[model samples]
Target: MMKNIQLKAMGKINLGLDVVRRRPDGYHEVRMVMQTVSLYDKVGITVEDQPGIRITANLSFLPLNENNIVYKAAKLLMDEFSIDQGVSISLEKHIPVAGGMAGGSTDGAAVLYGMNRLFSLGMGQKRLMELGLKLGADVPYCIMRGTALAEGIGEVLTPMPPMPDCWILIARPPFGVSTRFVYENLHLEKIDRHPDIDGIVRAIEDSDLEAMCARLENVLETVTIRKHPQIEEIKNFMRERGAVNALMSGSGPTVFGIFENERECRSAAEAVRERGMARQVYAVKPFNP
Candidate 1:
């Protein structure tokens, strides 16, 4: 039996996100086209005879105990299966933390995925995704990876065609935006425009990059941009440098630009760093797995 597992926890981007409504349970209803990107965090897990969960990470600020979603994931699985084996997880983070990308959620998904395999649990993707929902709204999509349409507080997922091949320039400023803060400040009645999520879905199915880029929008941007103008500045910077389109991914803070040309994408990444617009920038491609 395999007691050790190593996996790449892929990051994700919101091609188009629309806040449909707020649920009675206080969760927001959303319609979004989500795509996995090449950006990822490295996660390693080991099972021992002792019974406990230990987590360590490259980021010191990251909680190593129950406060972390990853730890919660480990506990969830162990409890569900009545496994008494000790588990240790080590994370090397490359994805920007709290940048609207599914960084932490993906890491948690990775733990669920790895543990399922390591212990030879019979849970399939569908079953794993259901358990993932208990960890976080985005965890299910992270486990589903590739391209998907996410709805119903992000637990409902429909696998979509892989996004058209293109360079994705991901840039995050020195600051991080709290997803909770953005949602708390959002007033749905005040939203002037909601993204055309159906239009984006059609574009992806047809592999029409131009149409997809044209429809790229995130309703959360209205709330996020107002508080941090740098989000807009980064988008403008990318657009001025020949990007097809630039938009904030999920809630705020991280802005990704789509480019057909690799040279232009790399050039933009360099310029963003040189201008001090964002210290963390990556020129990656769509990751469909």
Candidate 2:
């Protein structure tokens, strides 16, 4: 019999992101405040007598072979745990691909988490996170979902107080932003201002929404916004419509606004949609896991 397990692969937003410096190893050090959102993708995994792993997803463009992170996660667990059972993975994706929201990383994290439960592997969050880092820098944080502080190429994490109760309006424009382009063009010495990562952490601990929103910043905006001015326009639109504050998330074309009122959040979503500012928009709450 094939045993199946299902998991929710939640998306995350960066409350504040700062590029500390680039290392000789070619990886940049960063300090970021990460918050998980209610938005997620459904991931289903089945273990059976088959000899190899097979993957399927709702999106035709999503790769199902070993090139997929989900496949790599499964392979990692099977080889490490010496599990002989073959696996089949299915994804009903809702999170946008390459949206700088850690969409793919969360999906890979779900596979690691689901396999541990389905096979009764007894791997704790620590062990799972260790395995996840092998896949991607964001995978470790995705495994330990919630509000957190991420540093050291995004692998080091410190759980923080849950974000204050509020509605989040997420909007992603019709086009995609190239993360590589954003990073390659970033000159650390030229940046005038950096996000206050510690200050944002303190605001989160104090449960001060206004203070946190005011501090919300991402240094990459210098490069990304220059190439795509639409991002700044969206942020201005969200704020004018009733958002307490708004900022671009990750290396974005995706901008999110913090709204204290649910009605205001919904109205913002509708306006963004009506104006065709974004191809995808959603109103959701902060998710703590």
Tens-digit per-residue lDDT, 1-289, candidate 1 = 9979999999999999998999888899999999999999999999988999999899999999999989999999999999989899999999999988999999999999999999999899999999999999999999989999998898888999998999999999989888899889989998878889999999999999999999999999888899999999999999999899999989869999999989999999999999999868999999987
lDDT of 1: 0.94
TM-scores for all candidates: the values are: 0.98, 0.98
**TM-score of predicted model 1?**
0.98
Q: RMSD (Cα, Å) of candidate 1? A: 0.8
- Candidate 1 clashing pairs, residues 3+ apart or interchain: none
Give model 2's TM-score versus the native structure.
0.98
lDDT (0 to 1) per candidate: 0.94, 0.93
Q: Model 2 segments beyond 4 Å from truth?
A: none
* C-alpha RMSD of each candidate structure in angstroms: 0.8, 1.1
> Ten-residue segment with the worst summed lDDT in candidate 2?
1-10
Report the C-alpha displacement of residue 91, candidate 2, in angstroms. Answer: 0.5
